[model samples]
Target: MAIDPRGTDLKRLLSEDQGGPVVMLNLLRFDDGGREMYDQYAEALSTTFLPRYGGEVIYAGEGSTALVAEAGQEWDAVLLVRYPSRSAFSSMVADPEYQQVTGLRTKALTEAVLQVTTPWE
Candidate 1:
């Protein structure tokens, strides 16, 4: 859905300017967790974290079904949030409401990768 389908457009946008903090989260499982995992993140991010910081919940939910990989596979659910800054995200995670959801999410997923990346300057 771009001039290039290989994230070239995204990388180009990053190259030009990707101000502030962007976090990419990958939720993975062995086909066992059911719908609870997705539910928890949605609830927590929507009800708890997003409102607290005045930040943007850029993206969320299960990955695209259009593309499937040959070797392995994409994550079960993905989250892309843009916090005001790195510290805002850190503080939000430590906040009481967000902290409470950690237990729910912990029980929901078998594996996950929370990656924080600064866009290219």
Candidate 2:
């Protein structure tokens, strides 16, 4: 997800998790559950990024939403990715090989938001 160019501080999100260099990525929502399409998107991501940059898909899938966020709109999936470093995470998104699959990812979503944060302990 694209960071908030207007307000986000990339450096802040870079230091949240303690176990290693972490990026607390929160995917807010999706248009619907396009399982078949999503699967294809997932495969492309795992194949390209994981093998080279090296990170784990720490979490995924939806859960309850609090009675906040305007109206409790729940997530379609939540992905927590722990890359080797902030630079590595940023680099993955820009790689020519990974860029080829960007369309796959965008096709499965209607609305999505992601924030890379260092995550406060």
Candidate 3:
């Protein structure tokens, strides 16, 4: 049910920084008619904020046929976003301009998960 990160969550995310690029795993589930709004958000994000902050969408796809998962674990879509570093991601989220457009994402999702992943050694 949590769509956005709270202050505490942000603090924890930064604290866990491993001092390198980070790939964020986004598991998204949309409410009724939410996908369209999310698409608007994605358009703005990809064109504006991402380039400004050294972030990029590595992959994005609609979820289908979960081979294995708990009853409530299926997602509607998944996104993999890479940031130059944790600080860059933090900065992007903190930007006032980006904040203005965040509502699109907020309004689009019923539930979401944003997890940071480190590259495999």
Candidate 4:
């Protein structure tokens, strides 16, 4: 039921940083009528905040039939977003303007998984 990251979560995320670019994998489950609200948030994020923080969406799409998964494990959507670094991601979340619109994202999701990824050589 936790939609957004907390200060402790951010701290832990940053503490695990390896000082390199990071791609975040977002698995999202929307509440009823939540996708529309998330769409609005995504627009603002993609247009304003992402560019400002040197971040970009690598991929985003609605979730499809699961080829292999446990019951109740399917997501509504998935997003892959890249940031210059973990710190950059943290900064964007900390931005005052970003904070203004953060509620939209929080309200839109019933569940979410935000995980950081590193590239393989």
lDDT of 3 by residue, 1-121 (tens): 6898877888998999889999999999999999999999999999999999999999999999988999989999999999999989999999999999999999999999999999999
State every prediction's TM-score relative to the real structure.
0.65, 0.69, 0.97, 0.97
Q: Ranking by TM-score, best first?
A: 4, 3, 2, 1
Q: Candidate 1's C-alpha lDDT? A: 0.59
Each prediction's whole-model lDDT (CA): 0.59, 0.64, 0.94, 0.95
Q: What is candidate 3's CA lDDT for residue 21?
A: 98
TM-score of 4: 0.97
lDDT of 1 by residue, 1-59 (tens): 11111244334444644357665544454237645665866677777687787557677
Clashing pairs in 1: none
Which of the numbered candidates is closest to the native, going by highest lDDT? 4
- Over all chains combined, what TM-score does candidate 1 have? 0.65
Q: Output the better candidate (2/3) by TM-score.
A: 3
Error of 2 at 106 (Å): 1.0
Question: Candidate 3: where are CA atoms >4 Å away?
Answer: none
Q: Write the per-residue lDDT of candidate 4 for residues 37-59, one digit (tens) a residue.
A: 99999999999999999999999
Instruction: Give the per-residue lDDT digits (tens) of candidate 2, residues 38-78.
Output: 67767887776766898778887775755566554666677
Listed per model in order, the count of residue pairs whose N, CA or C atoms clash below 3 Å is 0, 4, 0, 0
